[model samples]
Each structure stands twice: as structure tokens, then as C-alpha cells.
Target: MSYVQQVMEQAIKRSPNEPEFHQALKEVLESLEPVIAKHPEYEKAGILERLVEPERVIMFRVPWVDDKGNVQVNRGFRVQFNSAIGPYKGGLRLHPSVNLGIIKFLGFEQIFKNSLTGLPIGGGKGGSDFDPKGKSDNEIMKFCQSFMTELCKHIGADTDVPAGDIGVGGREIGYMFGQYKRVRNLFEGVLTGKGLTYGGSLVRTEATGYGLVYLMDEAIKDIGKSFKGATVVISGSGNVSIYAAEKAMQLGANVVALSDSNGYIYDKNGIDLKTVKQLKEIERRRIKDYLEFHPKAEYKEGFEGIWTIPCDIALPCATQNELNEESAKALVANKCFAVGEGANMPSTPEAVKVFHANKIIFAPGKAANAGGVATSALEMSQNSMRYSWTFEEVDAKLKDIMVNIYRNASSAAKEYGCEGNLVVGANIAGFLKVANTMLAHGVI
Candidate 1:
């Protein structure tokens, strides 16, 4: 077996039952075959071995009280995976699915994702098994405070900086930032996704979604195609999906679909961004509620069936592994030309295979969905400078960054003999930077 294959097998042996981590490692390791063959020194130095393990894994108990005055407890984590280039940066995802395995998977993927942006930030991820879905504001606030009390020890303005992901959003960031300030007795850019009144950067909320679309726009445009008058299917109804829809519409693409955990909504007349934002962001209602406003639209029962909808492009903005091989084949059969991921690892390995095999213009989440963290790093820069840029300025910078990322990934793929294989290209491009940095600093 090859070194890549051996390392993957060893990783599985070391971390059994960590399917997500295994999946991430497999994808990255598989891509590194060409890279490793070129640089045998990386393997000789045990870079891959050290890179697989986090530098620090913090796990703690978070105790809080509900509005009913009942004592509650939740687990918290901060997987500072690697800081070869700069401080550890990722997001805190508050969901029931939060676990060490899932967080490590996210953190591992982040190591490369952050590198892909050509930013000075490293990789890390954290979250809790606490579900904020049905919690009241006060209860969530208490939970955030308790979670940060322990978290404050491991993070800072120049150290580990976290932003929002999934269940953790503007509200959650506010609660956590307030608690971090209270406990640390210091105010700093320790967190991104903050509200405008604080250290938050403009366009941070819409960065990932906008960036995802930006990457896709570059992809299709490379093939002499454009979003103008193209039919696009975007999954998810959260910040990523909502803003992606808005940007696609702005670019003249017809976004005809969006979804949530319960189901998906399809409107042949195109998705109403205003309605989606109001229903999901403001009201926190299910996507089915979208049908109440657009009575002419159709509501399906499951998210999987969404792939059957024909479109020129498909953006999987929902949770990880939400799209599978079956759905990918369905997309290919429907003659879908592109697939962009707005969420991390939203596509399974099998699904990715189908996209590549069919020659679909596939944009990996790390390269395509990196705008959020890139903007967070920008927010950190602004906080240090004690100033903020206008919306247009930050947005223009973001667009430039996305364009560069697309070019770098595309170029890296071609250079590495996998022309147009962004999965390999993104992984190699990201890994090469961090690995070289690691090599220069010497192994830790």
C-alpha cells in the first residue's frame, strides 16, 4: 500500500468509530498522494502524523440554570488542532450533534480550509451538545455564559478566535462575547460574528454565503457560463442559504429552492429571499412556513427529494453529509453542471465521486465556503486597528479573496496533475502552505 493508504489505515486504527474524522482524513489523505510523491521529506518528517492530531483538546462541563431555575449541564469543547501559521480560528457550533468526533472532523478540515484562504489563521473547532432550538433567550444566555467561563481560559484576541456556526449565530456570539468579557475582565476581538455595535465586521454575517456564490460564479464563468438567467438550487434556509439566494438573485440567477430539517420548498417563480430571511432568521420558523406566503410554491416532505429538482447548479448549504451518492447521481442524471458546498463536508465521499466522475464543476466547501472565516480574520485585523471599513470596502475585499482562492485552487490542481479536480487541488494547495510552515518551524 502507498504511504497515504497506510496513514489512513493507521488513522482508522487509532480513531475507531470516528466516522466523520475518518471521512475527512480519507478525503485529504487521498488527495495528498501526488503531493507526497513529490515531497518524500514530508512523510520522512512525520508531518502527516503530527498533523492528524490536535495540539490541544479541551473538554469541560458547562453548568447553567434554565429560566425555570433548574440546574442543567452541557459539554463544551475547543479542539485547537493546529497553529502552524497563526492563531487557531474556526466556529462554535451549538447543536445536539456536537461531539468530539464531529468537532475534530470540523477542526481537521478547518486546518486546510483556513490555509486555502491564504490567511494567517490556523485550524480549530468547538461546540457543545446543547441544543438551542427550543431554548428561551435567557436560558441560552445562561448556557453561553457558563460555556465561556471555561472557554475563556483557552482563547483570546491573539490566540484562538471563534465565530458562529449552525446554531450559534449573532445572538449566541453576543451572549458568549459578553460572558468572555465578564469573566476575563477584558474586551477584545476574541470572537467574530458579533453585532454591529461591537467588534463585528460588516458583511461577516453574509460572508460565507456570498463567498460560496462568488466561488461558483467564478467556476461557471470559467466555462463561458454565468449565473445570469441560470437556474440554481440552493439547500438550507439558514444564513448561508439565505444570503446565497440573495447574491444569486443579485447576479441574476433564479434560485428556485431552499430547505430546512423538516423539508424543502420549491417555487418555480424563484425563491423569495425576503420571505426566507423573515421566516428563518427573524421568525425562526420551519421552511414549510415559506409556502404560507408563496402559496404558488411547492413544499416537499424530505430534504433528499430536493436533488430531483432540475437546475444548472446545486448548492448544498445544509449540514454535513446531507447529500449522498444517490442524490449526486440524481443531480448528474438531471444534467446539473455544478455543485457548490456552503456547509462544511456537506457532500459525502461517494457523492463527491459521482460529481467528479460526471465532470460536474464541483467546488469544495473549504475553498468555496471560506469567506466566513476569512472575514473573521479581517474583523480581527480591524479590531486591532481600532477601526472598521464600510460595507462596500469589506465586500470588495471579500470578493477579491474569493477570486484568489478560486484561482489558487484551480492552478494548484493543474500543477498537481489533477487539472480541474478542486478536491485534490484545494487539499493540496491548503496542505502545502501549512506543511511548509510546519517544516520551517520544525516539528512540534
Candidate 2:
């Protein structure tokens, strides 16, 4: 068997049952075939083997008390996947679905995502299986404290910096930061995604979504197309979706849909950003509540049905594997020309294949959803300098970073003779940086 295939087989053998991690591994390694051929030294150095195996995996039990004085135990994980280039960086996700396999997949993806950002940050991801939904503020705070109490040991401003993901957000970040400070007795930028009042940088909240749109705009503009008057359907009503919808609209696109895990809402007349923010950001209610405000909008019971909506552009800002092969075909059949991922591995490999076969402009998550981590790095810089950039300044820098990502990915794809296949382009470009860095550092 080939070196890449051998490495993949061993990875699966060692990490059995981690389907998500296996899938992420296959996607990136398969794309590196051309690069591997060009650099036989990578195999000699066992870079593929070392790259797949995380440098460190921290797993601990988090014990917290509920509002009723009942003790609850949850599992926490931190996969410090790679730090060849710089410090480990990623987010901490808190959700019922979070597990070792999921965190490994996210961390593996982050290795490339962070590299693509052209920032001096390595890759890592940590989170817990503790569901913050329906938990009171006190209960959530206790969990964050418990989770951070142990996490603080493996992380620092110059070591590993974690932001927020999924169920972990500003509120949770605040709780965890407070705990980290108390435990470490140091006030540093060990975490990103902080609120502005403390040390958060401006435009950090909107960075991911805005960055997704900016990259998509660059991709589409290359084909002489623009967001103006385009019908855009974005899944998820969270930060990425909301801000993507906002920016798409700012560029003159008519965003018609947004969804949550429970279901989706389609506003044929265009989504009202205000109402979505109120319903989701403020009220923290189900997406079905969106219909009460916009009574004319249609609410569906299933999330997959959102893909059937006709549109010129589709942004899957939801969870991993939310969009499948069937959804990709449906979008293609409906004349959807472009798809940008705003979530980690949101599109299944089959879905990505369908998009490529249908000639859809597809942007993989590592490159497309990288805005969040890239901005998190920016926040770290701000925290280190003890200064903050204005919203416009931060936003401008984010746009430039995203644009360069697209250009570099596009150039890499063309150079490798895979022109327009951004999945391969992004993987190759991201791998070269880390692989070269690994080689220069010798076998760790």
C-alpha cells in the first residue's frame, strides 16, 4: 500500500470507533497525495504518523453541583493535536454530543485550519460533555469552573489558548476565564472570545460569520459573480449564521433561511436579523418561536429539509455532517451554485464529492470556517499588547486574512493541477506549512 494509505490504516487501527476523526484524517491525507509525492522526506521523517497522533490528550472528570445541591459529573477533553508552528489554539465546546471522537476530529481539523490562517498558532481543541442548555447560570458557572480548574494546568497564554464553540460562548468564557485567573493567579490572555468589557477584541463575535462571507465573496467574484440580489440560505441561527446573513445582506444578497437543531425557518421575503437575534441571542428560544414574530415565514420540522429550499448560495453553518449527499444533490438540482462551510466538517465527504461533481463552488470548513480561530489569534495579540483595536480595524484585518486564505488556497489548487478544487487546495496549502515546520524542528 502507499504511504498515505498505510498511515490512514494505522490511524484507524489505533483510534478505532472514532469515525469523525477517521473521516477528517482521510480527507486531509488523501488531499496531500500530490504534496507527498513532491516531498518524499515527509515519509522518511514519519511526519504523517506523528501528525495524525496528537502530541497530548488530556481527559478528566469534571464535578460540579447543580442548583439543587446535587453533584454532577461530566467528562472533559483537550486534544493538543499539533504545536509545530506555535502555541496550541482552538475552542472549547460544551454540549451533550461532545465526546472524545468529536473533539479529536475537531482538533485534527484545527491543525490545518490554524495553519491556513497564516498565524503563528498551533492546533488544539478541548470541551466537555456537560450540556449547558437548560442549566441555570449558577450551575453553568460551576461546571465552567470545574472544567477550567483542570484545563488550566495544560493551557496558558503562551501555551494553549482556547476560545468557545457550540454551547460554550461569551457567558461560559467569562465563567471559565474567572476560574483560570483564580487558579493560576495570573491575569493573561489564556482564552479568546472574551466580552469587550474585560479584554475581548472588537469584531471577534462576528469574525467567523463575516469571514465566511468574505471568503465566499472572493470565491464568487473570481467567477464574475457577486452577492448582490443572490438568494442565500444559511443554516443555523447562531453567531456564524446570523453574522453571515448580516454580511450577505450588506452585500445586497437576500437571505431567506436560518435554522436550529430543532428545525428551520424560511423567510421568503428575507430574514430579519433583528428578530433572529432577539429570538436566539436574547431569548434563547427554539427557532419555532421565529414564526410568531414573522408569521408568514415557513417553519419546518426537520433540518435536512432546509437544503431543499431554492437559492443561489448555501452556507452550512450548522453542525458536522448536517448536510449530506442528498442535500448536496438537492441544492445542485435547485441551481445552488456555491456552498461555504461555517462549521467544522459540516459537510460530509460524500456531500463534498457531489458539490465537486456538480461544479458547485465549495469551500471546506478548515479554510472557510477559519475566521473564528484567526480572530481568536487576533484577540490574543490584543490581550498581549494590553490594547484593543476598534471594530472597523479588527474587521478590516479579518477581511484581509480571509481574502489571503482564498488566494493562497486557489493558488495551491492551481499549482497542483487541481484547479478549483479548494478542498485539495486548502489541505495541501495548510499541510505544507506545518509539515515544513515539523521537518525544521526535527523529530519531537
Candidate 3:
């Protein structure tokens, strides 16, 4: 076996039961064969080994009081994967599915995602298995306080800066930031995704979803096409999905479908973003409620059926492995031309193969959905300067960053002979920057 294969085997064995981490490592390492082939020193210097191993893995217990005065407990994790280029930067997910494997997978992906942004942020990820659903505001506040009490010790503005993900939204960030400020007694930008009254940026709320569209726009244009008059089916009705749908419609695509964990809503008349925001953002109701307003639309009971909807473009803004080989094949069968991932590792490897086999323009999440972290880094810079930029200014910068990200990944693919394989290109392009930085800084 080759050196990369040997390292990969050792990684899987060392991190047993971490299937997500294993999958992430395998996918990243698979593309890096060309990189290690050209630079054998990467193997000799043990950079791959070191890169796979995190600098720190923090696991703690969070105890909070619910509204009923019941003491609830949850597990929390913070994996600082790499800081070769700069401080650790990523989001903190608050969902029941959060585990060591999931955190590790996200952190591992973050190393490359942050690198692809052309920013000076390294990679880290932290979150808890705490479910924010159906929790009262007071209960959520208590949980955020308890979670940050332990998290603040390991993070700083100059260290690992965490933002929000999954269940961690603006409301959660506010609670956590307040707790951090209380305990740390510092008003630094230790966290991103804060509210506007605080140090948060204007366009931060819409960055990731908008950025995904921005990257997809560039990809479609390169192929002599555009989103104009196209039909789009997007999964997830959360922050990323809503904004992606909004932006796609603004660019002339009829966003026909969107879903949540429960089910999906499909309206041929195009989804009403105002109702979606009200249902999801304010009312905090399931997507099934969308039918109450759009009586002409169809509401499906299963999340799987969302993919079967005929559309020109598909955006998987939901969680990992939501789009599998079966779904990818279904998408191709329906003649979907593009798949833009707004969530990390949203498409499985088999799904990726299916897309490539069909010649679909697949934009990986790291490059397409990088707008969130890129904007988080921007928020970090603004917080450091004690200033903020207007919505237009930040939006423009985000667009440029996303366009450059596509070009860099595309060119890297061309350089390595992968041509249009953004997966290989994104992995290699990001790994090269981080690896070279590690080489320059010398192994820690």
C-alpha cells in the first residue's frame, strides 16, 4: 500500500467508531494522492499524520435547569484540528446528533474550508448534544450559559473563535455571548454570529446561503448558463436554505421546494420567502405549516421525497449524508444540472461519484458554503478594529471572496489534471496552503 493509504488505515483504526471522521479523512486523503505524489516530503515529514491528529480535544458535560426546575445534562465538544495558518475558527453546532465523530468530521473539514477562504483562520469545531427545540427562552439561556462556562476557558479572540451552526442561531449566540462576557469580563469577538446590537456584521446573517448562490452562479456562468428561469429544489428551511432560496429567486430561479427534518413543501408558483421566514424564523413551526398559506402547493411527508421533485438545480442545505447515492441518482435521473452543497459534507462519496458520472456541475460545500465562515472571519476583523461595515460593503466583499474561491479551486483542479472536479481541487488547493504554512512555521 502507499504511504497515504497506510496513514489512512492507521487513522481509521486509531479513531474507531468515528465513521463520520473516518469518511471525512478518507475523502480528503483520496484527493491528496496527487499532492503527496508531487511532494513526497509530506509523507517523510509526518505532516499528514500531524494534520489528522487534533491539537486539542475538549469534551465536557453541560448541566442546566429547565423551566420545570429539572436538571438536564448534555455532552459538549471542542476539537481544535489545526492552527497552521492562524487561530482556530469554526461554528458550534447544538443538536442531538452532535458527537465526537461528528465534531471531528466538521473540524477536519474546517481545516480546508477556512483555508479555501484565503483568510488567516485555522480550523476548530465545538458544540453540544443539547436540543434547543421546544425549549423555552429561559431554558435555552440557562443551557447556553452552562455550555459557555466550560467553553470560554479553551477559546479566545486570538485562539479558537466559534460561531453558530445547526441549532445554534442568533438567539443562541446572544445567550452564549452574554454568558461569556459575564464570566470572562471581556467584550472581545470570541464568538461570531452575534446580533446587530453587538459586534456582529450586517450581512453575516445571510452570508452562507448567499455565498453558496454566489459560488454556484460563477460555476453556472463558466458553463455558459445561469439561474435565470431555472427551477431549484433546496433542502433545509433554516438560515442557509432560506437565504439560498431567497437569493436564487432574486437571480431569476423559481425556488420550487424546501424542507426541514420532518418533511418538505413544493410550490410550482415558487416558494414565498416571507411566509417561510415567518414560519421558520419567528413562529418556529415545522415546514408542514407552509401548506396553510400556500394551499395550492404540495406538502410531502418524508424528507426523501424532496429530491424526487423535478428541478433544474438542487441545493442540499441540510445536514451530512442527506443526499446519498440514491438521491444523487434520482437527481441525475430527473435531469438536474447542478448540485450546490450548503452544508458540510452534505453529499456522500457515492453521491459525488454519481454526480460526476452524469457530468453534473457539483460544487462542494467547502467552496460553495464557505461564505459563513468567511463572513465570520470578516466579523472577527471588524471586532478587532472596533468597527463594522455596511450591509452592501460586506455583501460585496463576500461576493468577491466566493468568486475567488471558485477560481482558486477550479485552477487548482486544472493544475492537478482534475479539470472540473471541485472536490479534488478544493481539497488539494486548501491542503496545499495549510501544509505549506505548517512547513514554513515548522512542526509544532
Candidate 4:
């Protein structure tokens, strides 16, 4: 190992409790091995050490009132990992699983993902351990308002801009933006996933999912393959999976499966995208409810089984570490050719190793799902210019961005002597850009 690798390994060993942080840093450092050897300035600057640690981590209590006149409190976190490229920009997730580790992982991945977008944005992520599921609209609004009450103090248009993730979607963004506007007493582009009335960009909702498929399309085309007649299995029925399914259908692929936390539903005849959108987005119901709408579909009680179903492509749109080594093995054993992560770090390091060793065309979340934040940055541009691009225009731009991102990653891997390894490619591509900026800016 090189000096930089030794230093990074030692630093991670010293912080064993921070496995997510270590895993994210290790992946980047491993990919940048060749770059570190070439650019000794990065080693001298201790970029790896600085990059492993977040610039700032904020945690606070979010107290709210329920319709029953009861008080509830949840923990909120924001990990501002790096701002060498620009201001801190990412998303706010509102799920029961929110924690420091989860936020750190997401923020670390955001750093690279944002860098790949070629937009002037840094990396940050924040969220609360408040589950929006089963909550009434009024209850969710109260929770979001309360969560934003404290979050608004630390964020702004130029300082830190947050969008939506997981449980935090249009409704949550609406409530949070309303609270921020009320508290700050100013209407600014402080958040990206805002409603159209409040300056949200057209096609922002479909950006990430569409971007994932776009990246997948690019990767397959590079290998003389196409999405036509490809069988796909997607985890999570949220915005990402819903639109990914839509785009996959448009590309002539059959998306056979989709999942929620409760379980996943598989249909041999291909899933009905409209029914999923209505159940997950409109009704806010569970995945099990799909059985009521389509009796022919098989609903399993866990998400892991989704991978076991035979398919040509797999998209893990659920939470982090959703696909483990076992699931990855199942996919590869079933002749899965591609895996694109729509969710942050949905595959474990072991799962990634399996995919890489088996030569699967794997696209990391940072590279594949960057479309969301890329469009969010575009939204910021529109907010500043007081104009919004049409959906077709924004989508066309998104496709171009994804194509460039894939080329950047592919080229980075080749330059680093790790050709065909996207994990390394993405890390090197993202790290070099941010590291160079940090070197130019000096210690801060």
C-alpha cells in the first residue's frame, strides 16, 4: 500500500465505530490510489484525513405536537461533510432510521455525486428520525413544520440547500419550506424540492429515477447492450423506483418487481406503474396493498426476495445496505447483468465486491442517481434567473449530464488502471475534482 493508503487505513481503524464513514472513505481512497501516487500534493495536504471527517455535524431535538394534543420528540441530524466545491447541498430524509451513521454515509456519497453533476454544489445531508408513514396529513404537516423550525436556523439559500429524500417528499418539502419561510420571514430558494408555486423546477420530481435509467442506458450501450426486453427488479416504491419503472417501460424494459419496507410485489406480466404511483404516492399505502389492486401479483413479506427473482437488471432504490452479499449473489447467480443504485449506498461493500468480482455492469448511486441534485442545482439556477425550463428541456439536460458522468467515471477508471470498475471510477472522478478545489482553496 502507498503512504496515503496507510494513513487512511490507520485513520479508519482509529474510528471503528464509524463504519459507514470508513466504508465510504475507503472506497474513494482505494479508487484514488493511482491518483494519490501521481499527485503527492494531496497526500501532503492530508486530503484523505480531512475528507474522512465531516466539516460539521449538527444534532438536535425536534419536538412537535400530534392531533391528539400529545407532544412528540425526535432527533435530527445534518452532516455537512465538505464544501470545497460550493455551498452544502443535499437532501433531508425523514424516516425512523435516520441517524448519524446514515446521514454521514449519505453526505459522503453526496459529496461525490454532487461533484459528478458538474454543478457548483458541495455535500451535506440532514434528516430526522420521524416516520411519515401512517401519519395523517395534518400530523405530517405538524411534524415537518416542527422539524424545519430548528433546521431553518442552520440553512439558507447560499449556505446549505436541502431537497427531499425517502420519507421527505413533496408534502414534507411543502411543510418544511412553509415553516422556513415563516421562521425566516423571507422567501428564498433555501430548498429545492419545493412545490411549483414556490419555485420548484419542472421535472425535479422525476430527475433521480430518470437519471438512474439514463445512466443504466449509457452503461449498457457502451457494452453494445440495450434496455430493450430487459427484465428489471426494483426495490422501493418511492419517487425513485416509481419513475425508474416509468422510464424503464419507455425504454422497452419490463420492470417485474417493486418493494416497500413492508415487502415487495412481483408480477411476471410486468408491474402496473400507475397502480404503484397511486398506492405509494397518492394513497400513501403499503406495498402489500398492491395485492388488492392486482390479484395476479405475488406479494412477499420482505425486500430481500426481490433480488432472488430472475432479471437482467436490478435497481436498489430503497435505503442504505438494502442489498447484502447474499442478495447480490442471488442476482448474479440469476444472470443479472446490471445494477444501478438509485438510493445512497444501497449495496453493502460485500455486495459491491461481489458485483465487481463477477464483472457486473454496476453503477454506483453517486454517479447514477445524481440527476436529482443536478436538477436541484438547475432549479437553483432557475430560481436565481426567475425562470423554469420545460420538462423536456430539463430532462434532455439531465440525460446529457448522466451521459457525461458515465464517460467521466469510465475514463477515470481507465486512467487509474482500474478500467471497468465503476466503484473506483466514480470515487476517483468525484474525489479528484473536489480534492483539487480543496487544494486550491487551502486549509479552511
Q: Kindly report which residue pairs in candidate 1 clash with one another.
A: none
Residue range 1-444, candidate 3, lDDT tens digits: 988999999999999999999999999999999999999888878999999999999999999999888999999999999999999999999999999999999999999999999999999998999999999999999999999999999999999999999999999999999999999999999999999889999989899999999999999898888999999999999999999999999999999999999899999899999999999999999999999998999998889889999999999999999999999989999999999999999899999999999999999998999999999999999999999999999999999999999999999999999999999999999999999888887768
Q: What TM-score does candidate 2 get on C-alpha atoms?
A: 0.99
TM-score of 1: 0.99
lDDT of each: 0.93, 0.95, 0.95, 0.90
lDDT of 1 by residue, 1-444 (tens): 998888889878988888999999999998999899999999998899889989999999999999888999999999999999999999999999889999999999999999988889999999999999989999999999999999999999888999999899999999999999998999899999999899899999999999999998998888888999989999899999989989999999999999999899999989888988888889899999987899999999899989889999999999999999999999999999999999999999999999999899999999999999999999999999989999999999999999989999999999989999999989999999999999999878
**Each model's TM-score?**
0.99, 0.99, 0.99, 0.97
Writing each residue's lDDT as its tens digit, candidate 2 over 392-411 gives 99999999999999999999
Model with the higher lDDT, candidate 1 or 3: 3
Clashes of each: 0, 0, 0, 0
Runs in model 3 lying further than 4 Å from the true structure:
none
How much is 219 displaced in model 1, in angstroms? 1.1
User: lDDT of candidate 4 vs native?
Assistant: 0.90
As a whole number from 0 to 100, the lDDT of residue 388 in candidate 4 is: 86
Lowest-scoring 10 consecutive residues by lDDT in candidate 2?
Answer: 279-288
